[model samples]
Target: MIKAKITVTLKKGVLDPQGKAIEGSLSALGFEGVNSVRQGKVFDIELTMDDKATAEKSLTAMCEQLLANTVIEDYRVEIFS
Candidate 1:
């Protein structure tokens, strides 16, 4: 079995309203020295494949097709046994 960790994050210079809201809330709650905050999504997927390379390719394709928005977001895949 193989495991994949996919991270989807907004591109640079794009506005992150949810991140901003969390930052504001943290500051309001007296969390000092909070410079900035960005939010992202993480997906954990398990596959029955044996080859790491194939698993990686399938995970990347999945991200491109459905898990991530390529125009505004970037995705990274990490595969492990």
Candidate 2:
């Protein structure tokens, strides 16, 4: 079995209203020196296959097809045995 971790985040220069709101709320709660915040997503998946290469390819395909929004978001995949 193969375990894959996927991270999806907004591209640079994209406005993150949710992140900005969180940052503002943090500041309001007395958290200081926080420059900015960017929100992202992480997905932990398990594959029935054993080949890392195939697993990676499938994971990438999943990201491109449905997991991540390629236009505004970037996704990274990491595999573990």
> How would you encode candidate 1's per-residue C-alpha lDDT over 2-73 as one tens digit per residue?
988999999999999999999999999999999999999999999998999998888989999999999999
Alpha-carbon runs more than 4 Å astray in model 2: none
Candidate 2, residues 1-81, lDDT tens digits: the string is 999899999999999999999999999999999999999999999999999999999999999999999999999999989
The RMSD of every model to the true structure, in order and in angstroms, is 0.6, 0.5
Score every model by TM-score. Answer: 0.97, 0.98
lDDT of prediction 2? 0.97
Residue 57's lDDT in candidate 1: 87
**C-alpha local distance difference test of each model:** 0.95, 0.97
